[model samples]
Every structure is written in C-alpha cells, then in structure tokens.
Target chain A: MNEKLHPFHIMILIYMNQTGVVIMSLPHLLAENFGYNGWLGVILISLVVNLNIFIISIVYRLGKGKSIFQIMESSLPRVITFPIYMILIGVWSMTGCMVIKNYVYIYQIMSYNTTHAMLLKLLIDIIAYLLIIKGIYTISKAATSFFWITSWMLLLQLFFIKDFEWARLTPFLFKGDTHFLTGGFIVFTAFLGYELCFMLFPYADNPKKFIKSVYKGNLITTLTYLIFCLICFGFYSFEQIRNMMYPLLDLLSYIRLPFIERIENLLFGFFLFTTIVSVVLYSWSAQETFARIVPKANKKVLAFIILTFGYIVAWFPDTLSEVGQWLQYLGYAELGVAFGLPLLLILILVIHKGAKPS
Target chain B: MRTMPKAAALLLVIVIIAGCGDQRILEKQGFIQSTGYDLNGTKNDEKDNRLMITVDIPKSDPEQRMQRETLTAIAHSSKEAKILFAGQTELSLVSGQLRSTLFGVSLAKTGIWKHIDTLVRDPSISQRVKIVVVNGRAHDLLVRDYPQHPRAGQYIDRMLEKESALMSFPLVTIYDFSRDYFDDGIEPIAPIIRENKKNISFDGIALFKKDRYITKIESKQSLIFSMMKQNFKKGEISMKLGDGSKKQEYLLFSSVISNRNVKVKRSTKGNFNIQINIVVKGSVLEYSGSHELSKDYDRKKIEKRMAEYIENEAAALMATMQKHNVDSLGIGRNVRNSLSYEEWNKLDWNKEYPDADIRISARIVIKDFGKFK
Candidate 1:
C-alpha cells in the first residue's frame, strides 16, 4: 500500500475513539464514588490512564518494523499469542456493538421513534461495514475531518458557565482514601480507548514520533474529560450529579437560541457520527486480527463477517438495562485486555532485549 | 439488474420505517403547558394518596383571546391524572411542553417529592419546568381566567421568570429542587405564590425540611435572602426611613447591584460560626428623609443607616429560616465541605442549624442621590 497514515492522523483516530458514549456516564460514576472531590479523582485517573498509554507506547517502540499483530506472531509462541488475539477480537467485537446498542438506547428515549431497535442496529452495522471496508487510511481521513467539526460540541458547555456554582467543588479532597481510589477506578473505565495505541503503531509513517502522537492524543482527550467533569460538577450540585444518567445531554437541554429549539436532540443526532466512528475503529481492529485465521480471504469480506457478528451481539440484549449490564461486562473485559496485553507485550520485549548477543 | 432491484426494495423498506414515527401532531396533541396539584381530602386524611390535578393548555387559534382549556381530575399520580385528562379532553394529553407545576400549600406541606417522581421519570418533560408552592389550593388558581393576561400558563411563567431575574426570589426549577433535596446538608426552597381578590402574585418562598414544606419567608425580604444566597442584579430595595412624626418616611434605591460572601469558621472547641457580609451598590431612586441629598456627611449617615437596617433584616431572615431548622442558605453545606467525609456524616446539621452562631452584616453604598446623578 502506497498510502501511509501520518502520526497526526493516528492521534486524531485515537482521540475520537477515547471520547464516545462512555463520557455520558462518567460524572455520575465519579460522583457516586467520590463526593465533591470528583474533579481530583478525574485528574488522578487521567494520569493513571496516561501511564497505561505509556505501556502501549513502549509496545510501539519495541516493535519498530512491524504491526502489533505481526510482533505478537513473531515474538511469542503460538500457544500464548493465539488466545490473546482471540480474546482481543472477542472483546473488541462485543464492545463495538455495545457502543451501538447504547447509541440506539439514547436515540429511543430522545427522539420520537421511527425505526425498530433491531432495524436501527442493522442500519448502524451496514454503515460501519461500509466505512470499515474502506481501510485505515480512509478511516483516518474521516477521523481528521470529524475531529475539527464535532469539537465545537464542547463549546456548548459555555452556555452553562454563568450557572456553574464553583462552591460545589469547594474544600476539595474531603473524601476518604477508599472513596478517592474507587473514584479513580471508575474514571479509568471512561478512558478505555487508548488501547488502540498498540493497533495503530505500524500505521504511523514516522514510527519514532509514534509515542509523541499517542501522548498528544491522550492529553487532548484527558483535557476534554477534565473540562467536561468540571462543567458537570459546577453546573450541578453533588446530588444532582449523582442522579443524572447522561450529564452531557442534560447540560445540552439547557440551551435555547433564536435559531434552535431542543438543542440536545440536534446534538444527540450529531453525536451519532462520533458513535459510528468509535464502533468502526473497534470492529475494524477486530477484523484485522480475525483475518489472520483465514489469510486467503479478502479483508473486505472479513469485515462484513465481523460486522454481522456485532449485529448478533447487539441482538442479545433485550432491554436498555440488560444492555447496560452487557456494557459493564464489556468494560471489565476491556480493562483486562487494555491493561494486561500492553504489559505482557512490554515484558516479552524486555526479556528479548536481555537475552540478546550484547 | 437483479442487484439494483434488491437494493431499491431494501431502500424502500428503510424509508417506510423512517417515516413511521410515533405521530403527535400539534393540532391532534394536547400539550399541558402547566399543571397544579392539591390534596384531595381534609388535612387529617392521612391514608388518602388521592390528589386533585388541574392542567392548563393553550388554545391553538391565533385570533382567540383568553383562549385556554383546563381539565381537573382526582387521580393518584401525575401520570394517572394525565390519563384521566385524556379521557375527558378532545385531544390526546401529553406533557412534552410542561412549563410549570404548582403544589397547593396543603400538598406541599404534606410532601411533594413522591408526586414529582412522574415528572422526573417522563423523558419528554424538560427539567426547566418551574416548580412552585401556592398558599391555597393550586387548582383554584389554575382554573381562574384573566381576560387581560389571557393565558394563565404564560402569565405565571413570565411572572416567575421576571421575579426571579429581578431578584424577588430564586429560580427553583425541578432540577434545582432535586439537587438540594438529594444533597446531604442542603435543603430545597421554591417560590410560594398566593391569590388575592385582585389577582395571583408571588407571596414569598416556601422553605422545605426535606421534601415537606416547613415554613416560609415573606415576599418583602425575599430579595435580601436571595442576595445572601447569590448576587442579584437590577433590584429595587426600599426601606421606611423616619419616625411616625414625619409625613415622608421612605427611601428607595433602584438599579441595585449586590453580592454576598459567606465564610464559615471553626473554633478550637470544634464549633462552626458563619459570617455573612452583603455588599449593595445602587442609586437612590427616591428619598423622603430630612437629610440634604447634596451633603457628603448626610449621605454617609444615610448609607450607614441603610447598612444597619439591612443587617437587622438579614438577622431576622436568618432567624426565621433557622427557627424552622431549615438550612436553605446552605450554611450546613459549607460546613460539610470543610470536614472529611467521616466527620461530615457524623454531624447532624439539622440539629445544629437552629442554634448555630451566625453573624450577618451589610455594607450599603448609594451611588446616586437621584436618577442618573
């Protein structure tokens, strides 16, 4: 392939992936565990997640000439790498569909209904399949275009600034040791997309700047999470934050302009774009990994098969609450893959380095 | 040709699905703009969960004057009441545009949290819906027609909106009320309104002890309480000036800009004392005092007197709220944040609130002796 992704493109891709449907539930999670000290908790977790990204960065640095899948195939025995790839593909495919299920749930409640949930899920799957088959270069180009326009959604929080009560965060760090740590753990779930770092490593044209690009992406997302956490915390009392299911959408409902009515409904439609990109990234990663098992097949065909698998996973949940439980399971599985794989990959590199001729 | 035909069939199916939305046209749907709830029976009827609900909907015709329809029913919940209303009304009753919900004094004092759950659960209702407490049966106020004001929903909405903006009272949306209700150390308060022979108007604020309304602050000093909680812009604070011997006895300050700073201090004995300082900057719209307007010392004396009066009034307002054991000012919230979680949970702020040593002071500055001086 002549076309290669720039480090900047990789950064934008990872950035988009980190901040999808998960941001809606974040403030409530933090507030449930930590009281007014939720802001501090968010900052602490962002740093820890950054540390996890550093582990992925080490994987990028060690595997200089190859993709992470290629590196794994070469470095480890088939016994280990095979199960790891299978587990990753399973988790990624389920998680991708889970994002769509969540988006459909939001759509069902917010908009006057038209299509049935199954039909909506199928539509999402088809759109995602079309995009995923276009390959990574095209996906990155889409992400780049999307990163500029959708970022203005952050500016919507500015309308709530006059109503923000800073006292909601006053006398910070008043919570106990256990609550603070637990809050950090909850926030870590929100920063799950950085695991894509390992997958996107070989795509960067200048491989040396890979770490810098990843860090840049992580920082911008961290800053995004931090700004939103502050806005939500300040905009609501601590109790209000606890009761809110989707804080960003609730915040959007407050705005009314001369030109617009029900701004949140419009924005929810806009966030549909972000949700599509997120699912596309995860399912595409799954397709690439699953392609190894059937090397003779076309990747475009493989992507369709993976997209069908996502549709089946999405169908398993009968209701919104059931879907939430499924997402919780996906989140735990993701944590396992996100934290465990990078650390294991880095360890193999360390051992490989130690056993060298020098 | 076969592939193209299959694609077109699929596209048609999807298009049909897209257009088959839950139909709720403006003319066909009854949009409940405002609702009022009153306790159904006598005050002693404890077991009766029944409520009398009154809903007001705006007329669709542009040419019609005072064109609003009201439906009243005895139902168990706001949702049930809506179902009952739909049975009686021509159009389907929906709460999509629910702008105001008022609780009668009897219902409010009994508790409104359970009744408000329907509003919170309904995905269509906006959190911006104004929640108010009416002194008499809210149904009485909801049914009355004002030919001059036309739509009571719009009138009441504009009344609450304008009063809150002008600093007559705080803007207590259901979101705000729930926030304070759910918080550990704070309490919720809402605009208390009552109707007289002349018309319906804002009376004061109804303070709550948890979900139940415990007491109220009169409309006169509501602005002062509002300022203590937050800053107020474009207010008018008028005071009685001279003794009964004087014919002219009032001073009015308009275009008011005021702010408050509340500080909580703890002594070595583990006691919390609150110090509140309110600063008011406004122009003198009118003065009936004997002091010369042009003189500096007289102006200083007037400012000092205004400060003293405001400080006294502040003390009285705090006393009233404290007497009810309501921490509507969020003094307890401040004290809670100052301690660790363990320490905060251990302290019962409600027990401590009524007797807390709180000092309130005011510093008033009159920028203009007359309008645009």
Candidate 2:
C-alpha cells in the first residue's frame, strides 16, 4: 500500500490501454465513417477526449486525493455502492476479456488458423493473471517496458513515406461519409483507457502531477492515432482503406527488409505485450472492485477467480464478428463509465458541499 | 507428493493440445513462389468452367534435375484450383512465400479483379508480391524453360525487380494494384513480360481501366512513362534526333534523375487545361551530334534540341493515352485537387479526359557529357 505510482508510469499505462487491438482496424473505421481526409477528424476527436479528461481531473480535485472507493462509499450507502461495484466488476472484466479474445481471433486469422482460439485465449489469460496478481505498481512498471517493445513499430511508418501520396488523401473533407455518429463513437473508444486513471487517485504520489500526466497520456494516444490514420490514408486510396479489415496489418505486411519479409507476423506478436498490460490493468481494476465486496479475501485469490470468470466468458464468442459485436456493447458501456463516473463523482461532491453549509 | 502427480497430468494435456494446431512445416508444405492465371480455354469451349491456375513451386532437393515443378489445373474458381493443385503434390501448397502472380494478357484484358480479390483476401499472402501481366499465355511463361536462367518463376521475379530499378516498368505490387484500382482519380498499371526466343524480356507496361487492361506503353516509351509517373534518381534514356534529310544523331543519357509536376487550370472554356513539366538531369554517355561539348553555345543548342525532343515524345505519349481514354498518368488526380469535391463527383473523368487540353514541356540539364569534357 505504501508503493505509489509515478506520473510516468500512469502516462504509459493509459497509452498502452488506449492502443490495444483497435489500432489495427482504426483506419478502416475512419475511412468508412468520415470518407476522404477522415484522418483530419482525429484531431477533433482528440480535443473532445481532452474535455472528458478534464472532467476526470475535476473529480480528482473535488474528491481531494481520496481513493475512488473512499469517495463513493462515504457519499452512498452499502446498498447503493455494492450494486455499482458489481456492475463495475462485470463491465471491466468483460472488456478486458473481449480485448484479448478479439486479438486472439485476429491472430488466428493471421497465422494460427486451425488452433483452438480458446486455447490461445487461455494462454493470454495466464499472462494477464500473473501480471494482475502483482498489483497496480508492478503492472505500470511492466507497462513501461511493454511500451518500449511496441513503440518502435511507429518508426516503421517512415518506410511508407516514399509511397505515401498527398494526392491519395484527396482534397475533399468529410465527403463520401455514411455514418458520422457511429464513427465518432468508435474513434472515441480508441481513447477509452485513460478513464481508468480515476482508480489511481489514491495511488498517485500527487493528484496535481497525476492530472497533468493524464493529459500527457491522452496527448500521446492522440499523436499515435493521428500518425497511423494519416499514413494509412496517404498510403492507400480512400476506397482501399475502407475495404480493408485491418489496414495496419496490411501496411506491416508491405514492409520488406533484406533479411526478412512478412514482418507483420512477428511485429504483431510484439503487440501481445502491450495488450497484456491493457488486459492486466483492466483485470486489476475489476479485482479491486471485487475486493470491496469481500474485504477479508486475499487479493491474489480474488484476481485468480476474476480471471477464471473472464476465461469462461471469453469462450462464448466463437467467431471474430461475434466477438466484435460483443466488444461494441462493452466499448459503449465502458465509454459510459469513462464519462459517467467522473460526472457522478462531481455531482456527489457538489451536493455534499451544499449540504455541509446547512 | 500428491500435487506432483496432478501437475504431471496437466502438463501432458497441455503438450498434447499444443500439437493439435495447424503446423506448416517447410518441407511438407509446397511454398508457391509464383502463380499464373489464364483463361481456361477459348471462349467457345463447351464447359462453363473458365479458370486455368498454374503455380510454380521450387523443388527443394538439389539432387533433382528440375529446378521447379509447374502444376496447372482448370476449375470454376481459384480456391477450387488450389485443391486440385494440392492433390498433385505430396506437399500442401501454400501462398505464404508467394513472390509473384502473373495474369495472361487474355485474362487481364477481360478483367482481373476476381483473382486479385482472392489474393488480397487471403491473410497469408504478402501485399508486396509482384503483380505482372504476361504478354502471352501466363501458362506458357510459367511452363517455359529458359536455357541459362533459373526457374521461370524466379527468373521473372528477378527480372521484374531489376527492370523496376531501371525504370523500364512500374513495380506494381498487389497493394499498389488494389490501391490504384480503388482510387477514383487514377487507374492501376503493371509490368508486362513476354517469353522471348532464349529467355523472357520486359515487354511493356499494361494500362488498366478499373481492373481490365486497356492499352500498353511499349518498353521504349516506358522510360518516358516513368519520367512522368514519379521522380527517379537513376535511369537511362536514348533518343535519335534530326529529320530524315539531315544525318541523324544519337544521344544517350545515363544516371538520369528527373522530377515531374502536373499543373491543372480551369480555362475560360469550362474545361481543365493541364501542363506537365518534367525536369531532367543526367550525364550524356554518348552524343553523335556535331555540337561541341567544350563550347557553351553548342551545349545550349544541344540542350534546347534535347528538351524539344522530349517534349514532342511526351506529347505523343499523352495523345496515345487520351485516345485510348485512359488516364494512367493520373491527370484526373491533379484535376481533382483543383476542383471542389462536389464538382469532381459530378464530372465524368473518363468523358472529360479525352477532350482536356494537355501540354508537355521538358527542361534538360546535362551534368557531364561523359568522362571527357
């Protein structure tokens, strides 16, 4: 309990979570939703996400450095807080499980087609469980190393510069679009992981430093999304990007080094580290929520039980589309939590302040 | 002691399930190095089946007399053909290492998106695989044995790679093919290869409208096409100058570097007036002209003449493209940039392309006339 997270660790944790399996399909989604020069819309989406981050910061300032559980339990009775905690555990664990399940399903399509997806999911679950049992401080520490392992893939975008064409991006802005509302929601989900920082209010060495790091984390995620979407738009035609299921994977497949070709297979595996950080971070959050209900239980045992539940739930979605449909619902629910939690906490803080004057 | 027995059983189960996944062993799997697609037969053939898929798999054993094995099968679709191909060999045919996919002129002229879609859809195939348009039947090019070359597949792959560097043809891959095909402003193009007397040769560049081949730019004009297509650091261009009455002179430019710009302006006539300017810099390796290199006056004279020659040739090439109603140079892309999105969408580019006023101008800079002054 004495070990607190550094601001840098918090920044990386937010980044790794925001940049999971979604990156591979993000360009295609943008192309489908916003049409020509859809990448320009990422800046707008990032700005909006910053506003959401502002709300989370307000909760931090209002709650006065208290842990989320302390602030919530003090305001609401056990009857109200307990059901909220259960809902949080359900949504958080399923979101973590589906993120990995979607990744393994795509991995199956890429290389291990005949392998049982459940087996691969179990393998990833075991890695997540090991990391989750270590607790938040270790997970954040491991995330910094995981960030290094995957961030170099960004440099690969430079190879595409020779073929990237400004003309291919087209002059039209937001033309040929079909679904702006849904597209905005999907893109907003790309910045979903930063909200987990709320749980870290108590763990942060200083609330002021934590809030600043949250903005920096969101900024980094925005830059990563912009770089990827812009390169995809320039490297491919508008129609080509829309048609592709995973433009990032296809882009990686195009890269040819003297020693190797089809580097995507290996590079995509490196993403497992980053995704493991994300899944573990989410599982840790769920386990923290679970501990509130069973206060006397050991933390590691609760984490194991939560992960076992995740493993069982992950088995339900057998195909990629089915998993995607499940992720759509979870992503929206998580986004709701991301915005809803901070707003509710702020409302509670305001009401408490008003009643204290009486 | 009790836990030891349980752990042993769990590990054994894990090991057994691990082996159950699809394992593509190198020796057991036939790594398809190159593939060819041709029309099954003449159009009049009674059977409705239309695809003839040929694949070249390099033989692994050095002791074998043949360098590669070529297999051909006729079926309704490529996947069906793949199954037939697999039945003929002990190794399961796979496309992970597929280096190239060749389409016969016959098939390319009709349309090629169906086969290309299959290539793009398969997760195993690399997008960098060279896409080619064979001048004759793709089957003949795949099956032919050249006396001094490696296997036909490897030879063509190497040829395409080398020729691409020479700027003799555009190095279109599966990615580029589909990318351009999907772009509304421009069409896709691929290098054409033909089975020659002793070996294969770079035939030309096949221009495509959508996914169907429209016309071709010959090998000689391919350099001109390259100059207009994109900027290059190394290439060679040889031109014969002078009218028939005067003695003709030859000028060979090597180590060529060039940059091109397309400018589109809306004229008073309510149409796009496009100007294509190309700036070329290279050393003249050979000049049979009477102009003396040491003299500034003669150098200017030759430069002007060379520039004029390039301009004329480029204008002629543009005419060929316009006549064929193909915008392979991506003039539509330039025009699109100059207009609003709604205007571009409303305009029929193909209908407008042939009537557009396009002009070509060149500027030539000779760095060195050779090792001599």
Query: Each candidate: what lDDT?
Result: 0.80, 0.88
Highest DockQ scorer: 2
Q: TM-score for every candidate vs. truth?
A: 0.94, 0.97
Model 1, B1-373: lDDT tens per residue? 4655775688678757765656667787778899999999886777887999999998786775637789999998878887888889788887778889999999898799987776766667777888999999899998887666747788889888887778877779877888788776678999988877757888989999889999999999887887787776887878876444756558888889999988888888877798998999998878877887678898888888788888888899998888878898888878976777677778888788888899998998888777332
Best by lDDT: 2
Q: Which candidate achieves the best TM-score against the true structure?
A: 2
Full-model lDDT, candidate 1: 0.80
lDDT of 2 at A57: 85
**Interface-residue RMSD per candidate?**
2.6, 1.8
Regions of candidate 1 where Cα sits further than 4 Å from its true position? A75-82, A113-115, A172-186, A258-261, A347-358, B1-16, B61-66, B243-248, B371-373
- Model 2 lDDT tens row, B297-359: 888888888898888888888999999988888889999988899989899999999999999
